[model samples]
Target: MADNSKARVRRLMPEDAAPYREIRLEALKLSSEAFGSSFEQEGSQPLDYFRETLAKTDVFGAFVEADLVGVAGFRRQAGTKQAHKGYLWGMYVRPVARGTGAGKSLVKAVLDHARERVELVQLAVVSDNEAAQRLYRSCGFVAYGHEVHSLKQGGRYYDELLMAVALTLPST
Candidate 1:
């Protein structure tokens, strides 16, 4: 296992597009069932598409020394009523960095960023992904609902568990 004790998390910039794209594509191809998007769909996109996405979304990367090992993204919900909520998406950690603390650090970074801006942070994990579910739960997320056949890939369906963490305390 890599020494992820030295792992650091930071918001990805436009200049980090190439590496981000590399890891993202790896994630989609290696764990196709974990995401709603497909490698085929995103792999065809140009580099500028990733650069623009980095410029727009709050994507965070975890680096052990100089190598990027993991990534997670957060985005504010659209519309007036949903403004108090934000979605956590596209979380991926390289296989080599799985047992290390990279995933937790990335999740913490997203939650910390979302703390000041939204009341709740939400995410959806494939129902069978126990490791990811435990990670989210350890970070204070609770499953609020479950969706059957939430994702379809290669003619198969995946159920998803909707989870969220409250960033703000309830008023007394």
Candidate 2:
């Protein structure tokens, strides 16, 4: 296992789009049920699409000695009423980087960044994904709801747990 103590997390810039796309696609292909998007959907997109996405979303990358091993993204909810909420999406860590604290670091980076702009950060995890659910709980997220048959792939349905963490302290 790699030492994630030295792992660094930072916001991805447009110049890092290539590697970002690579890892994002790898994640989609490797764990198709974990994400809403698929390799076929994002893989066909041009580099400029990822560049634009990098510019628009707060995507954080976890790097271990210069190699990006994990990534997570944050995006504020659109529209006036929903502005107080943000979504944490596309979270993935390379298999080799698992259990090295990279996933935790990536979640931390997203939550830390979301703290400044939103009151709550939310994410969805497949109900069977116990490892990811544990990671989110460790990072302060709690399950607010569950959606049955939330995702359909390969003619099968996946239930999902909706989780959220409040970034702001309660008013005293």
At residue 85, candidate 1 shows an lDDT of 98
C-alpha positional error of residue 68 in candidate 1 after TM-score superposition, expressed in Å = 0.7
What shift in Å separates residue 123 of candidate 2 from its native position after superposition? Answer: 0.6
**Model 1: ten consecutive residues of lowest lDDT:** 1-10
Tens digits of per-residue lDDT for model 2, 42-64: 99999999999999889999999
Q: lDDT, candidate 1, residue 93?
A: 95
Candidate 1 per-residue lDDT, tens place, 27-47, comes to 999999999999999999999
Q: How far in Å is the alpha carbon of 63 misplaced in model 1?
A: 0.2
Which segments of candidate 2 are over 4 A away from where they belong?
A: 1-4, 169-172
Clashing pairs in 2: none
Compare the candidates by lDDT and give the number of the best one: 1
Give the Cα-based TM-score of candidate 1 against the true structure: 0.95
* Candidate 1 runs further than 4 Å off: 1-4, 169-172
